[model samples]
Target: MVSVKSLHGSAQLLLDVAGGVTRIAERTHRTIVREINPLNRLRDIAGVPSKEREGQTYRFIQSTMSSLQQGLHRSLDGFSADDEPTHSVHSEKVAAALNGVCGDHLEASNNPLAITMHFRNSQGAKLRPDSSSMGATFPNAGPRIVVLVHGLCLSHEYWKGHNEADLGIELQRAHGFTPLYLNYNTGRHISSNGRELSEQLQILVDTWPVNVEELLLIGHSMGGLVIRSACWYGSEPKLPWTQLVKKALYLGSPHHGAALAKAGHLLTFVMHKFRYASPFALAQHTSAGIKDLRYGNLLDDDWEGIDQDEFHLDIRKPVPLLAGTRHYFLAATIGDHPTDFSSTLVGDLLVRLDSAKGHHSDALKKLRIRPEDCRVFEKLNHLALLDNKVVHDQIVEWLV
Candidate 1:
């Protein structure tokens, strides 16, 4: 059963997208029509045309759209009954998908799909560490805690694969370490999410019933970037949780930048160059979070004032691993072998080999990781890195 909130949110999203498309089409049509007519071009250049001479058809279109929007808003507002507080798994999955695609837009509009940070247990119930809820949240939580962070467009449920074996559960059984999963908005800027994560870790550590002896983080894909960002923020003032962190593992993370996002930037540039193709290029415009991944931006300043539509050299500052903490990277390739050309070009199908391994020409952008600490798993795609036994064994070995 779809919640009323979900239906309303979906309708609003569609209407917003349609409205934007209409505006873009109108603008494109006006540009082409005016450019094809020499008189309009001369008038535009000479600045001799009065305001009254402006296209009446364009004015009519704008007025009609405004009126329609007003009517829609009124209808929506009147029909609104509060949606159920609890969401079904299917609804949550749909919301997560929509958020991944246009989360930035949803957030800006204060939509219901905007995700928030929640610590969840194996059964997907929210965990609260307060006096009343701590016992229920962590009945067997130990001194050492391991936090699992999932990738973009994913929930904590992703950690539990089709197989009965999961890294978090295995770690708990083998090492007696308490496991907690972070569920957050993947569409937000990495740095923004990182800052929140840093603060949340502080709260988690400070409120733990047992004294935290050690902390470990395991992040996949964009989650890895978020973890790095959190470390960078957590170390500025030397947060208490930062000192407890013993090891951080990144799996299939694009440390430098993902190739697909860079390709999107290039496509956007090309589409913008041609006037007729400009409106169609609107489809390529993505959330700020996706744009930040183009260069693996980890700091707020990394993207400040940068033209997202234009191609620029990697200007991100190097974020070194936290002192006193050992960092390990695992990169996967879909190629038959590690040395194959396919592995070099398409790493794990989403990230490239060099990018995932933190290789860059710029010294400031390169992350220094010892060769022994890095591992490459062949014949595995990006998501497979999450559940592969070999990868799981390697992580266990490192942790032990």
Candidate 2:
């Protein structure tokens, strides 16, 4: 039998060990987030234009920042990974570095965001034909086509982080892929904007605006699911799927559902239990938050396909579900988990691996994607992965 004194001593030792490890890891992550992270977000001199004409892109975009200033609206705050209070000194230093380093880009990320979602309806003109139809010239290659979709509460500027463009450059040089940033109302249902997106893809592919070998899509958070929904519905649209898409990747995407969203809903029901914050919070019931609520049930057996009725959005295109495409899942799991069930702590602080992969969905189980189809990278999170160069490197490798 164990003596009481010995048991007490062992418990204390274990606690001390756990505390030490947590402290070390938190500090390491803090250093990484504080140091390397801002570098990824830098817009100053990170990208060098291939030619003199291209340099204007930076100067042009930077000009927009001259008129922009910080806007007042509280974004959700994250507690330190260390669970300790944030030091004002560190905060000030980080802020100063950003202002100095990023220059215009820093100003853009700070506040008064820029919204760049201007796309035209270029539908149906035959962008692809395997030689015999439009000669071998069609759908071969050109400037290249790329699609970028942003996550919640953000605009295309999210990807404007010069680090993001670095990824784009890699895609172009290595795989001959171009960049196209997609912007949609974060408040709309998946199906609503999804069908619209599919239609857009169809048009983008059908037209011979440029020779294109591959159509790549990069979506973060809800953006990932939106892309899937578009692909699912787009495959059978009037235009057809193969004409448009090639491959897609999801970063920190909650393909299954969000755990924090589920928890937040409970709090939303009990007013006093939770404080009403951003319109992004739960105030907009029909927003992405609500969409996330019903999102988990997406794997329902009847989920063979989704449309306006199921998601409560106006689906502009026909909802003919496709089987599955050569898609890849790149999730930024929390990385270091000191627990038995790593899945729980796997995703960014808010999302778990299981939910991000749509594993939590009974609906998806009956569908094409099985357990084997997923790939998780534990080093990323919702925001970090976007600016993180390592994440872009992996994407370039896969796309190429």
The top-ranked prediction according to TM-score is 1
1-400: candidate 1 lDDT, tens digit per residue: 6666666577667767766776777768767877889887787788864445546765676677667656656666655545446787667766776766678888887665678887887677887757458666776668998899988787777787657567898898888878888988888888988999999999888888778999999999999999999999999989999999999999989888898888888888899888888777753558777888888989998988988777788777789878899999999999988789999989898999888888888887778888988999999999898888999999999888
* Root-mean-square deviation per candidate: 2.8, 21.8
Q: Report clash pairs, candidate 2.
A: 127-206, 146-180, 148-180, 148-182, 256-358, 299-362, 299-363, 299-364, 300-363, 334-346
Show where candidate 2 strays beyond 4 Å.
1-143, 162-165, 272-290, 293-324, 337-343, 361-373
TM-scores for the candidates:
0.91, 0.54
Alpha-carbon error at 68 in model 1, in Å? 6.9
Model 2 — TM-score against the truth? 0.54
Residue 36, candidate 2: C-alpha displacement in angstroms: 59
lDDT of each: 0.83, 0.50
Best by lDDT: 1
Count clashing residue pairs in model 1.
0
